[model samples]
Target: MKKRITASLASVLALSTLVACSQAPAGGGEVKSGGEKKEAPAEKVKLSVWHNFSGDDLRAKAVRAQIEKFQKDHPDIELDAQAIPPDGYRQRVKTVAAANEMPDVFFAHAGTGIKEYFDGGLLQPITPLVNKHPEWKNNFMEGALEALSFNNEVYAVPINASVTSLFFYNKSLFEKHGVAVPKTWDELMAAIKTFKEKGVTPISLGNKAAWLAQSSILSSLADRVTGTDWFLKAAKQDGAKFTDPEFVQALTYFKGLADAGAFQQGFNSLDNTQMEQYFIQGKAAMMIDGAWALTNMAATGTKEQLDQVEVTVLPSVPGGKGDPNSLSGGAGGGLAISKKLSGKKLEAAYELIYTVSGPEGMKAVAESNSVVNYKVDVDPTKVTSLFLKAYNLTKQVKFTPVYDAYLSSQGAEAINNGLQELLLGGKPEDIAKKLQDAQAKSLGK
Candidate 1:
């Protein structure tokens, strides 16, 4: 769910102007005119929330519905929810942060991405709040809260967990082409060749938005090549380097796919939505995307179309150190509070976070076919078969962190831009060096 913003620099600079104006604090109870001094009614607390649920998809609907319920239950709190597009969300957050105008509560990812805000003193530590509510802490799945923590302090509330490196294929197309489900790199390549021979795009990928390939394809490829251990070491600049053969091999393999015409024509120009449409229209045989996409697929496609789709992990790479079943995703996204919030504003923020990340919100997310981090009582029969398959697969696999989530913004941008370059005839070794250079600069090595 991470994306780089294409927002204008002027708008970002303008955010600084908004920061000078501060929100007025809520007024306390007033004394009555009577000699018997009766306390006056409490004033409504207004909170501004920023989130990336902008579309009319099921995920958006679920979020909107939860906001409505929260407003209904807490009439004293006035919530001003703004739905920013995913592409511009990170930039918007940065702009607000630069202005010192962060909303009361804002949507954020749960790893190194949030660490930036934590380091910058923009986010409020919520560990004490979680500790106070044992019920809330108990509801989260193991490691859910921890993923959102830094240096033993939790900063955000995880809403949903996800597996990003899933390959969703058109089952009917596979059957039509007499291609068996691939279990290894060779088999996958052979299928790609076969599909190409039959005038079908083997995989539908759109990189114009820039993050799709990195999050979905390259993340899984890195796992299959050097595994999670190497990635972590390399990211930390402990000893490993991106120019190492294993890492370069992963890039080379990714480049090979692009050269072999595995993806659609003009893939670099198509956005994520267009790529999904290509798969749904049967123009492509397979699509590599996050598990959250199931909700949208189920909401937009017919039952037959849903039945025609099947999910699987990336195929195993030969002589690799990684487990073939290792997946690339974790706690997908969460909510963080502004450090400026306190008293009633802070209380309302906590309630909103819990409402969205706790049982009530988790249930809605699960029912929509997306996996959630909280332990909600979801009816198995009510879940989509596609989601059930993903859920079951997730249980059987080792989860690896998404590259973008694990790397700093600078390092992530390097990998993302490098991948795009690699696909467009750039050398894998060169791309690796570029990434290495970016990592070094980011780490001040």
Candidate 2:
């Protein structure tokens, strides 16, 4: 039940084993004094951790900063960390967990994504850890830990909030082309036409990984046509189905965008970073992406360039049952600790997790324009204008569902792969039927 996140981790910068220092070494028993067990002598220990903060971008720098601070805080502990790319990191975590060979800690998705680790006893509930730092736990936005919990026990701590469907348009380009911001389906098409005719890509997409179409665009676009109510019903296979006319119509509309050359050429072959570069270079007029992209812009683009961008949801579609001002969103994932240690070593792992994802950690990353699950107090003047715009919009807009966040992995895979085909001129009807079948099969269980 992995989420098809558009942004990928490049390398794990922090994670690994915490050699138990408080406990007797290896197989040694605790030293006894007169009539009681005396505490073991403290020794320098090595803690291993794994993460993927390979980039020097603001987000990565923020993460690295937290790690360094954690090391400094625990001078007696040496961190043995390994870096792994995003896709490889996901697979690696799975492989190790399935074999009961996980590191002391690692990064992963939440919600249904983390359920496997919890159910398999591969993870430890952090309720006690949070309890140990009540102030830190209280700083989380409402319901942030629910995504990383099972049976009311949280297993991980999420760092960011993922509002996945946003349209980031270059205001300068709109003014230069004399095109008004799109407000309806027709206006969107018209704007696309105007930009395409002007030799500019109307939208820049990086979908080589195939999850972008589902996560960034259709999640909200389809809601604009199908409404959140119908999507929930369809996902549950209760009173609605994806093959219904509304869903097919949504697919048709998504395909129309592709057919109109709304996206830059070879979008299906591009990754998000490349697409971000393409958009920042002004080769495209707009890019539909998630909230995390705010950090990318803050890290890579100049102040002037960011100031020319406006963050907002996609325009309304005609006859859409969804709120025109809504976006597809849900709680995002975070890092988890392995259930392989006890006593002081386990305590060290929990402390390390908090050091990297708690209040202080979140506040550090927020400087990079990250919209985190933790409530961070930042000077408005210090944040990038790009993030400020998106942050403000989140307050005004309702959050709709992000498909992969709720759908069964099979159902999500269906839509994700189907959209890739749909964009290449495949039949919308065919894709809708496939989606319905997958959802029905998944929910039937």
Q: Which candidate is the best by TM-score?
A: 1
TM-score of each: 0.85, 0.82
Question: What lDDT tens digits, residue by residue, belong to model 2 across residues 177-197?
Answer: 999999899999999999999
**lDDT at 304 for candidate 2?**
79
Q: Which portions of model 1 miss their true places by more than 4 Å?
A: 1-38, 133-136, 380-383
Tens-place lDDT digits, model 1, residues 1-445 = 1233535555676776564222222343343334234456777999999999888777677887898788899999989999999878999898989889898999987778688788898987888778887887888766667668888888887777867888889999999989999989999999999999999999999899788899999998888899888999999888899999999999989999998999988999998877877887788999999876787677677788888889988999999888887778778778898999999999999888878766678888777677776666668788888888887777667777788887877888998998989999999999899889998899999
Q: How close is candidate 1 to the true structure, as a TM-score?
A: 0.85
